[model samples]
Target: MRAVRFHEHGGPDVLRVDEIDKPEISAHEILVEVAGAGVNPVDTYIREGATQPFTLPMIPGIDVGGTVAAVGDGVSGFDIGDPVYGTGIGKNHYGGYAEYVTVPDDRLVQLPEGVDPMVAGAAGVVSGTAWRALIDHGNLQAADTCLIHGGSGGVGHAAVQIAAASGANVITTAAPTYHDALTDLGADVVLDYGRSDLADAVRDAAGGGVDVILDHRLHEYLQFDADVANVGCRVLGIGENETGVGFERSSATRRKDLQLTMMTMFNTPDLRVPLRKLAYLMSEGDLEISIAETYGLEDAAKAQQHVIEESFLGKVVIVP
Candidate 1:
């Protein structure tokens, strides 16, 4: 099998496609013939040795969509020809950047009818993360006003649709170029993050304050989030600056008794549940996964670079 592996962590240049042996499955693992693998910002970080330690010569994809090529003896409810997609493929194991990857049976979900493998692969991480952040951790409700930062990225775009489908008044921040697209995705209000009065704009959009905030760049937006958060609001922190930046808790955050929770999709004990729900949403056309670009498996380096250095409104996928 051909796989993209980085022997050492540094930059996208470190990723190289090489012919490798196929991974064997454990009793509870299933072997997937990779059709599409989603490239995330975290993949870049992992390649740069920024995240937790990993085995050298690592495959860096976290999300995968493909068919079951082989199943372990203990694996059930999946067959050799079933289409599947899910996350956790790259974090704890070699990942999905190869022609074949061994994934735990529990981590793979049957692709809902009519959902494309590439779409499923691209949505695995972002959709699951958005669902967990807004629905599970944030407890966003239909009556709530939700504010999502970086609403043009992979997770941001998914969050916009998820929040909107949940009936929340979705207020998102993105560049002017993405405003109309975000609104089409169910964002009730889309503001330019570059606006000097972003906080005020958010407050006005949400009618004084927002009930929930999904923030990825907390170091840059923590104070701003506090400024526009409603009393007893929930702030779900999905990411932060990698530079060891510090942020002060604003007086409004304390005064409003807001709840601040930092989360990573990897922490979810059961991904299949949310993924199943997202799958239903996708099948029903309530959720849409946009593919910003697709690259061949050999161009994994370019895919990783585009994920970090480029500004795109969806996921970058690798077709193996």
Candidate 2:
């Protein structure tokens, strides 16, 4: 099997493609033929040594969607040729950058009928985060108002749709160029995050302040999040760490009785939770997944570069 691995971490140039041994499955794991894999900021973080440390050689990617080439012992209700998707690939283990990868059955979710693998690969991270944030952490209610940053991006678009589907009035931030797209996704308010004063703008759209704030860009918008949050409202942040402002305990703990949630779509025991809901939602037309673009497995460098540049709106995928 060919996989992307880097011996040293520094820049995108470190990514190297090489022939690697196919992963062997544990008793509870499944072997998936890699049809598509999603690129996320954490992929770059792992690749660049900004997040967790790994062995000298590593393949970096987050999620995979493909047919099960085979199932391991003790794994039931799943068989060969079944389509599935899930996270935790490149984080604690080897990920989907290879032609084939092994995944724990608990982390794998069968793809819904008609859900494309590439789109699932693209939707994997964002949709899972949206579910954990809005439905699980934020305690979203139909009458509540919420805001999401980077609305046209992967999680942002999914958050908008999920919140709206849950009956929450959703406001989102995007480059002005993506306003129409956000609106079409059911965003009641869409603000330009590239401009200054995101808090004031989102606040005005919500008619005062929002009950929940879902932010993908934490550092630049932390203080702004504090400003726009309604009293007693919760603020959920996904992925951003180590920088920006207001992340300090003193500042983040300041009044409005705020609840700050750090969101992760992986490392959960109940992997079936979001997968089942995402399946039902996708089938019911209540949730949507979007792909910004696709790259080949060998183009991993460009994909990493794209993450650093933040030039893409949604997940960038590598199709095998």
Name the top lDDT candidate: 1
Task: Give a tens-digit lDDT track for model 2, residues 1-320.
Answer: 89888888888989888997888888999999988898887888788787774566888887888889988998997888888887766877788877898988777888878877667766667788888898898999997999888888778888999999989888888888889878888888888877776667787888898898888778767777777778888998885656644644555547778888876777555867887788778767777676777788789889767766865566778886
- lDDT of model 1 at position 21: 83
State the C-alpha lDDT per candidate: 0.89, 0.81
In model 2, the clashing pairs are: 142-167
Q: Distance from true position, residue 86, model 2, in Å?
A: 0.9
Using all chains and alpha carbons, the TM-scores for the candidates as numbered come to 0.97, 0.92
Worst-scoring 10-residue span by lDDT in model 1: 243-252
lDDT string for model 1 (10-120, tens) is 977888988988888899999999889999988888878877546888988999999999999998899998988989778678788888899998788998789887779
Name the weakest run of 10 consecutive residues (lDDT summed) in model 2: 244-253
